[model samples]
Target: MRRRDFLATCTAAAGAAALAVVRAGQCAQGATSEVAKYAAWRRFADTPFGRVAYVEQGTGPAALFLHGFPLNGFHWRGSLERLAPHRRCIAPDFMGLGYTEVPDQQDLSPQAQADMLVALLDRLQVSSVDLVANDSGGTIAQLFVARHPARVRTMLLTNCDVHENCPPPQMRNSINAAKAGTYDQKMQRHLDDPVYARSEKGIFGSAYMTPANVADAAIEYYFNPLVASPRRKAQLNRYLAELESNPLLAIEPALRRLKTPTRMLWGTADPLFPITWANWLDQALPGSRGVRRVEGGKLFWPEELPEVVADEARALWRV
Candidate 1:
């Protein structure tokens, strides 16, 4: 009970309590980290084309997420997780994207992508889906909606390709380079530098308003699979080469006639798919629920604004 002994014991107790508090904070933050999110939902299915990698969560009316070009199901990771509790959220990596295997002799055209998506849904026994799409996935979603309206319950199309504006002008250089067999080299430059990769005109630049907010894991999730092999590079090349404005162009008439209730969440500031395109979508499709413009939204609003996307989807389904 000496004074020095009691003081020493008190200091030790205080230090231990502080350590516990620090550890607790770390655990709380860790729960929402990129690794935790990526680990949450991962599955693969064998389709006719190849093995398709997807992330699925929850169990209710199916909400299938389709990602744009140069990205994969991971692009839908945040929104998928948010919507999972309410609906069955399925985000699949297409044949030439994400963790999916590419067919050797296949062209991977937009129609081919449409068929592949259907096959994916069939393999999973998904009869009908509330389709949610962004970027180039919007183009393929249009094809699917136009070609097989019966299987689609409703649709949410964010910033993406419509009509002959597939790839838009900003994205043409990469596609043209891919045709000339130099895409891999071009992409490598951005892949090498994380900062440059997310810049305004970079790979994911136009996608996000605040590029620094993007997780390194999200970027790697899209790049690692495609960059792992030369075959994947070729597959990506075939995907780009097939984008001649024909596939989506051919489906324009069907799109105008599409009756599946459609909603568009547009990023108004997106240089590639501006608000004008959103207006076009609203006017073109008779079934459109109309456009909801995000004032500072970019191409990657799903990543940047998952809650808004989830809220909009919930509203659509409630109707």
Candidate 2:
């Protein structure tokens, strides 16, 4: 079948199946259960990028979840649990973050991250997916759709890098720190003091809606591996430096022409990626269903608001 026809057919089938899907709240409680199983559930795929680390759940048609910067697949634990009944959910740690082991010379650019996704999906035998992404992962998702449109059945994007605003002005200092090789040191500080890590001055405070509610264990799981070794720290720095360039500019035309069904669920409180970019996306994509505002939500809200993610994914996928 033609790709467009396939997508249309899939949408219809998904809608029919969605009626039997469980309520988001009922499954949301299981999100924490997955957290404990994360280490034991973790699996690795030997891709050209490296031994890529990923976690999966559920069955049937695949749904791929791409997480934000410094976070791994664990970011999607809630969504995975909530949506597992409807789709095979897979979430992988990016090359420079989480538990993914990359070679010293691997490219960490946005384009390279997109290329890695292609390789990782191929290795998993998943030809296409319902693409769900947040933060930096949203940038890579745009690149993925532009470069491989046929591989995406639909998309659900949260606050993240958009065209021309790839490295948002607010992140200038963070990028500068990465260039100065102090980025890892800053992360070390957060790791050393979990109390401060969730403080208004720390990452969770700046990115999440409820900073103090963030657990210490989650903080360790997210930052520990990124600073585990000298090579890992250097890799993390390389990943941040790469965001300085704008890969989305060259792909704006492609995005404008894309037909993959997409929904932009943006966090209004996110200073890094404001709601304006979501408006830009609504105009850019032909298949856009329009933007949904997440009032008072921030960059990392997807982690804290999985039920919201699950609801939007089901809506976008017609399932």
Candidate 3:
């Protein structure tokens, strides 16, 4: 590539990355009990597609969690504590990114993601359960519910990348940027910037009750998947293609057909998905309970509003 062309591409990516974060907040200094309450189900290995690692604890009716992009179910640590005691909880790291490895041959589209999630439920003998999804997980959960309406009893969504309504030109630009080479270097450059780090305080901070956990968490847990620049390239390419292919046609058409009670949770401070997307989602789902507003919340409310999540889960499941 010509030097000028490469520089232009990098400039676009930097601009997209800058907009992606509004400002991250200062993380905390100590290990809170919220961090210790965490426990893992180990390598439980029974999935429709591949062996998956899930964090399972407490017992009652089942509640399944799907993690967002760039992070796995580990992001839902606080959500587990809130929902578990009232009901059985299982949150899995989505394939190619978390504890779950990408299957030998699996499609990365939303439909395929939905199938993988249902397979996880079936292997665990979970016929139907409540679903909570944040960020990209929200997109996956929506696809899953559309495919098998009876399988999802309820859904709580955070700001996810839903494109049925035609996302902004910048979103597409960002996807293109992520698909380009030098992703690792580009992503690191952004992560270390104070302004970059300052933005999305809600995204990383929601998972931890304290700031230290957010800071010191292993790069493997926080960034390994993205560090796989090739995979990052593939994912971004697939994602953009999915966006262009009218990929959400299946899911979008099925939203109104969804019988599962839906509650979209939004972080008021999020910049990437933004509060406006919430309005778009509400209008798309004719009967959806509308996006529940969070005053100062960013994208990860399951951490910021664990009690609210627990309350809604109980009401939805009658636990």
Taking every candidate in turn, the Cα RMSD to the unseen true structure, in Å, is 6.1, 14.7, 12.0
Q: Going through the candidates in order, what is the number of backbone clashes in each?
A: 1, 0, 7
Question: Candidate 2 regions off by >4 Å?
Answer: 1-34
TM-scores, one per candidate: 0.87, 0.89, 0.74
**Candidate 2: residue 216 lDDT (0-100):** 66
What TM-score should be assigned to candidate 2? 0.89
Which segments of model 3 are wrong by more than 4 Å? Answer: 1-40, 103-105, 163-168, 187-213, 218-220, 225-246
**Per-residue lDDT of candidate 1, residues 3-47 (tens digit):** 999999999999999998897566546534765567556778888
lDDT of 3 by residue, 188-244 (tens): 543555243334433354333333334433333455455455665455345444443
Query: Which pairs clash (backbone N, Cα, C closer than 3 Å) in model 1?
Result: 207-300
What is candidate 1's CA lDDT for residue 76?
Answer: 73
lDDT of 2 at 251: 93
Give the number of the best model, judged by TM-score.
2
